[model samples]
Target: MSGFVAGGPPPSGQTSPDGHINTSPFWPSIDLDALRGTLRLDNSISPPRLETAVIAAAISVNRELAAWRIEQQAAGYSKLEEVPGETVKGVPEQVHLYRRAIEAATGAEVCERYRSYDTTNSGGKKADDIAPNIDDYRRDLRWAIRDFLGTTRTTVELI
Candidate 1:
């Protein structure tokens, strides 16, 4: 037999490029392959785990936007896409920002969970190095959600 495998679907643990992750009825479904490619996630993450992370991210994003969503619905915009936004490339800016929020939240969740995958001394150091990145991911998430909600990122606190 040749080294090349016969044509077929991806292995059990791998994700199909055409797969989509459905979100709440008001939100758009996310493209699984697009997220994996954009995040540079590889097959090391099984499809189930990837799906779990994506779902968690979606839930978090939806919760954060819950009030805004209700307001939009009251205004007669039945879906997220129906809410007006500037077009970026061929997509609406709100959709892009919403996707970005999900991706950032997923990145943070994955990195935090995988930090313990390796327990060697070097792995400990690696985990330390990733700490700042996790914070950055969180920051990105906040910015995306705020942008989607049409709010400023700054926080005012009396000190």
Candidate 2:
């Protein structure tokens, strides 16, 4: 994985000690074999596709947090290095949140199927076709990234 360049926080994301961050991979090089157990996925089936999705999701998650880092920096955070994943709001288990980011990006879903037509009753019951769902990640991703860096959430009293 030579060019497996995880975008180590975008430039706008934040500055680090000496204007450089710990360029080490935020998470270890994901071992698909190991993730199989944690993710409850069996490798005997389509491992390549699953692995690719997970890797892509991880990169996406990193990029998302990079933006949050930038915002945190602008909000007057100096010691940014001390902040990432420090068990703050919106992030309980950092690793678990990363897993969720993967699931969100890939739109991993489980649903029961139903076959029926629209129904309406004059005064008893009513049903209609549903509007399409837009794949918006802004809120959910930010919620996951809230504690990825310095000072994500704060309040000040003005007098």
- RMSD (Å) of each candidate, 1 decimal: 6.5, 14.9
How well is each residue in 43-156 modelled by candidate 1, as lDDT tens digits? 656667778889999999999999998998999998888888789897889999999999999888877876877899988987787788788889999999988888899989
Where model 1 places Cα greater than 4 Å from the true spot, the runs are 1-13, 16-18
Q: List the lowest-lDDT window of 10 residues for candidate 1.
A: 1-10
What is the TM-score of candidate 2? Answer: 0.38
Candidate 1, RMSD to the unseen true structure: 6.5
Q: How accurate is candidate 2 locally (lDDT)?
A: 0.40
lDDT per residue (tens digit) for residues 1-159 in model 2:
010122333234222223311222444344444443433433222444554555566667767677654665677654333345456455435555555455444333100000022233521221111111112333444555564343355558899
Clashes of each: 0, 2
lDDT over C-alpha atoms for residue 34 of model 2: 42
RMSD of model 2 against the true structure: 14.9
Quick one: best lDDT, which candidate? 1
Q: Which stretches of candidate 2 lie over 4 Å from their true place?
A: 1-24, 69-95, 103-143, 146-159
